[model samples]
Target: MPDDEPALAAQRQHWERTFAARAGMFGSDASAPARAAALAFREAGLRTVLELGGGQGRDSVFLAASGFEVHALDYAQAGVAAIQRAAEAAGVARRLTAAQHDVREPLPAADGAFDACYAHMLFCMALTTRELLALSREVLRVLRPGGLCVYTVRNTSDPDFGRGVHRGEALYENQGFIVHFFDRAKVERLAAGYELLGVEEFEEGALPRRLFRVTLRMPLR
Candidate 1:
């Protein structure tokens, strides 16, 4: 809701079109990190999980198959619909719920509704540092005390910075969206309330993609 920054809106619109046109590329695949996250959730006794920016629910389907009650949220209408279709095809419709939710607004769920949360490639979509922090806080708010937050973001230290559009070092504000690069230290500082359990950086695929995978735990107290 709030009037989205125009540039941000444009970028989102671009993504919406891309997702709508290519829904097939968004579904479940066998990825090591995804499988690892699901296994971690199961071992930690997290039966209920909410996946923010769940895209087409590839991860959601995996989590549900792993026996977790999964709620997959995305802002794109087509993305949600694709997830729903995928769930039905997989025969896990009863265990998976796909809905349209703007993470910038209050999460459309009860407080402490889930045992854990997972966001793969969700935070990177945010264009601003403020938006990222706000989204992070909102994620914290919905999670139960001691619940885990596992997510990934592009690292500032990645050798490929500015390779996309050659944007300058200054904060790039497009429409209403803001995207700033972050290193491990910055992420740790922003995620203050949660204990930073681990950080892993790796390059994937032939595109030489850089990813920082992190696991954080909300304090039980």
Candidate 2:
């Protein structure tokens, strides 16, 4: 593990405990962003989706049932198992795959293996700026040319942006979880190798956490 990003390995353990404690922590419904992404994916003729941080499989089951081939990855073992359970219960097991993976490493898929990549608030996790950049490059690597990457992150406008214990590099810890806040410049910096398609701000949860939904695309040569 990299010394600078020490919080990540601990975070995996935190998530493991959290997921084990609460079976359906995020509830059964798919997030609004996932619903929106599904429509866009369908319209774009993208059939395969790689979902990162697929907590509890809310979006994984939804996407699979909606006809997109879904492969959901989460660092926590319990979370990954919950995804598989949810997929099986939804009868979408045939269409969905769940795996435990740390996104800090290279993505598990082959080059050009997916048609689209989606992650709802995954970018806002305990990852640092450098880790985010590397993860973005990995996303680009696994996507087919012209494939789309849709991800959301809490922005600087979020209510908890600077609250709680400060981790290095735009990250803050609340309770036991850490979040990395983003701004327009950071988004643009990560968009280096991809076409920046859109950046839309939205709100979620009772705290009304402010977030940005970023869409990027690999260019066709």
Candidate 3:
């Protein structure tokens, strides 16, 4: 099968290069958003989770350690390797699976294969608005009924919004990375198939990025 379309292939190559330059792209800690989702996962009795753009497997390892089966997907092979090593070291290898995947394509898992889905800044990773909408549908497709999808994205209120060169729509090419900042309207529009649970605003990093933690649940049939 084809790896990815031209645009997505370019993005994948960029992330691969980034990961190769450093031992690990993101740090070893699970993202705050992922940690926050654990409580909701517990409340819902979720067992299996599909994590998109799981850079270096930090959140996957954490989720697995927390007793949930995690399938962590990233575009970079190096990141997948890191996740595999981390899971083994954490003694959660049986509970964690890592693979290289591009979310721009349809998710490879069976329908309703996962009890929950998580993404940390995956929606903001240079994907176009249309691609994000398609991905939301794919996420919903792979999730079991009533499964929750939790994701974070830089919001339009972020301090860095519009600070970089425009890359079309709400996207910007900043420094060496590309970002597609979301607004409340865009979030709602993209998440139409699912029930919106809540949206929380939080800040992170030195840029003090304004981000939204969006929670959506597939309606029970």
Candidate 1 lDDT by residue in tens digits, 48-154: 88888777778888888888899999888888898899899988999999898777778887777888888877777644556667777777788888888888776
Per TM-score, the best of the predicted structures is: 2
TM-score of each: 0.88, 0.97, 0.94
The parts of candidate 1 lying over 4 Å away from their true place are 1-4, 166-180
The superposed Cα distance between candidate 3 and the true structure at residue 61, in angstroms, equals 0.6
The window of 10 residues in a row where model 1 has the poorest summed lDDT is 166-175
Candidate 2 lDDT at 9 equals: 58
lDDT for every model? 0.74, 0.93, 0.88
Clashes of 1: 13
Residue 79, model 1, lDDT: 84
- In model 3, the runs with Cα more than 4 Å from the true position are 1-9
lDDT of 3 by residue, 1-221 (tens): 32124544477778788877886557888778988999899999999999998888889999999999999999889889888999999999999998888887899899999999999899998888788989999999999999999999999999888877666787776766778899999989988989999999999887788899999999999
What is the clash count of model 2? 0
